[model samples]
Target: MTLSDETPGGAGMHVHRLLDEAFAGVEMGPDQQDLKEEMRGNLVARVTELTATGMAEPAAARRALDELGDVRAILDATESRPGPGEAAWQPPRVRPNPAFAVRTVVLSAVAATGLLVLVLAATVVDVPLAAQIVAVAFVALAAGAITADALRQETTTNHPVPPARAAGYGTATLLATTGLGAAWLYLRDAGLPWLVAGALLVVASAVLFTYLGATQTNRHKAWVLRQQAPYGSDRFTEDPAAAARFGIYTVTVWLVAAAAFVALTLTAGWEWSWLAVVGGFVAMTVLIARMLFAPKA
Candidate 1:
């Protein structure tokens, strides 16, 4: 069957259309329906495999159908199989372990709480240097542990990241947290040395992150990719007006931020000018979330 020039959905829709055509003239009872669904799953699986190997979605779907051969022959062979109400073989689903999930949650909460307490103490009260250092290390460890543990666990839609890469990510997070803590110390008049160290740590983490991101390969499962195919890469494709508005808003925000930055740099000093840039970034992010991802009324 010929695929439409533009199926709203991606590879999954293509396979679905092909499946519908294949079953068009066939009679389907509950058993047949079950078999059809099973077949659909298998077909989608094959398509996913093909796409991952660099084939286009339509080509992958076509190849999967070609490989599938005669659908009726399989049905005929399976006539004596158990009915839908009985037990049937199905694909195995991968899920995160319950223990892992709980551990991740606990560690994340611990990290968050530690960071919050540290921030509050630094600002609201005088925390001793020894206590602050211990707190920083505790929070860093928690954040790193959570990052590594979470990445190593297989999820429903994505494969577990490689251990080495996961460790690298964890290290980056640890360094970033430590850097932030050092910055806090500097803000509290700990020393200029704290500021220099914080800047170095932050820069190191940023470089590591850049390297990791550049070399990262796709970890998304085939099924997830298929599901996402329909939407394509651009979230705003379906709303040209929204896209235009976002562009306008972003330009406006940055323009205002640039003016503010200049004004702050001249009057308030460069130390405070960076806040304007940070605020601009936050505003842009909020605009994106609201404009593109907000639920339709």
Candidate 2:
């Protein structure tokens, strides 16, 4: 079924455009033409199904393509014979979206500017505390935006992370950035409140990150997963229960660390409390190594 130009805007158009890009430069033998047609039909159906479920047409088309996973693999499979010295078929590289590239550049510039302002305020310039706070917030938000946008984009060998999960990652990034900023302010002798806020934000980010890691499923497309099969999957994929246990362990570690940090701040000193955070990080690293690298049963 040819995708006619007369077809109205929606999944059909998106699918057609995608198929054009995917099949470009490939010699269209009878078998290849048939395969392309079959793929186009299947992809259109999948996109239509996805769009019916409230997904945007563009996103639906992309998801459908992602599910197909490396169109070149299928094309290679259909080849009955290889001509003499047909150079190794390399998969087409997925280029970064122009719009996304521009967005990243802009956000990076903003983040850098914010950092410059913050350093100047803290060290050389006698900028107002309010202005310094604003600079910190800007940097945090820019970082968060970059993280979220990156997660939401489809990579060469992996599908886009779900929007909700991407947003969670972004939130964690923001919390960590803000926490670092707060810690810096406290080091500048701002106040005990800043110290408390910094510690809490850091702990919160750690918890969120642990949870995300534990719950994350593989997003690699079929071809990517196949290539990785020889290396073997992670223990968490093999035993989900282990992942759950690790998540619990991580949470407990961080909570205890937070409590210790507070107690040390009260009894020893704010200077000594940071040791609690460092200890917690070391504990978590050891836990990861033990869980992920233990001898396979």
Candidate 3:
């Protein structure tokens, strides 16, 4: 009748399948994930003891699951608003990681210094091969660390930043490096001298900041939604309304950029019309930055 607690039975995998089936459409959070593990471990232990006591493996598993009863009912009763005997466990508050900040700051400083050296090399032609190599190494390491840290955690109990978004930030980091490098080299040939290179570098930096800031802001908002939502769920922005708004915002930005390009070409001629693209980018960057840092009241 009683089950042992030494180890899980061979029926462990089956029990997992059962649990997954029972909670198939359920939205899971960090605490819920933990509870799933707890239930799986406990049930398998019970089944193992039952089998040891001469019960068939399948029969013991069924018996244990029967004891488990309704999955939704159990989770609903336990996740939040715990009973008198249990302690409350909510998601922890977000805090800045000092090491992560250091990596970000170092990456920025290295990029600036490297660009300055590249600019200087245009005139001197002797920027030292060893220094260039060291600059490249530093950029790679610092950028990698900052990107990794962004996706590492949101709070103690939650993986708040979605994996999809994390992958995006990482991809942007790689593209940022390439874009800045290419723009620098291209402007050198375009003959605006140092100003063009500096402007391109500034644009690259702005774009990088916009991607990181906008995505991180969205991730935090999602976490807030999950914390306040009901039914043992942590899903966010899963509706058509949110999608529509995002679509509109995207379309509007591109429309403005295109309009700027045509207007500048007509008014200022071809030589300087390309600056419209840069102007539109700066405007969009300012908009995103404002939204990202807006008051959270």
Best by TM-score: 2
Candidate 2 lDDT over residue span 204-269, tens digit each: 999999788878877876443433343457898756678888888998999999999999999999
Against the true structure, candidate 2 has what lDDT? 0.81
- Write down the TM-score of every candidate: 0.50, 0.53, 0.34
For residue 90, model 1's alpha carbon misses the true position, in angstroms, by 8.8
Greater-TM-score candidate between 1 and 3:
1
Q: Count clashing residue pairs in model 1.
A: 0
Residue-level error in angstroms, candidate 3, position 102: 14
Worst 10 residues of 2 by lDDT: 1-10
| Candidate 3 deviant stretches above 4 angstroms | 1-130, 157-164, 170-198, 211-227, 230-297
Q: Candidate 3 on 1-297: residue-level lDDT in tens?
A: 233323333566556556666667779986677566666667778878898999877677777878987767777767656654573433334677787777678777876777667767667766664555455445544564467567765664355566666655665564455445545454455335434654665576567657556434343433333333322221213343334444456658778888878988999898878887887688678765654444435
The alpha-carbon deviation from the true structure for residue 108 of candidate 2, after best TM-score superposition, in angstroms, is 0.9
* Candidate order by decreasing lDDT: 2, 1, 3
- The number of the candidate with the highest lDDT is 2
- Candidate 1 residue runs with Cα over 4 Å from true position: 1-20, 23-93, 123-125, 223-297
Measured with C-alpha atoms, the lDDT of residue 114 in candidate 2 is: 89
Candidate 2: stretches off by over 4 Å:
1-88, 226-297
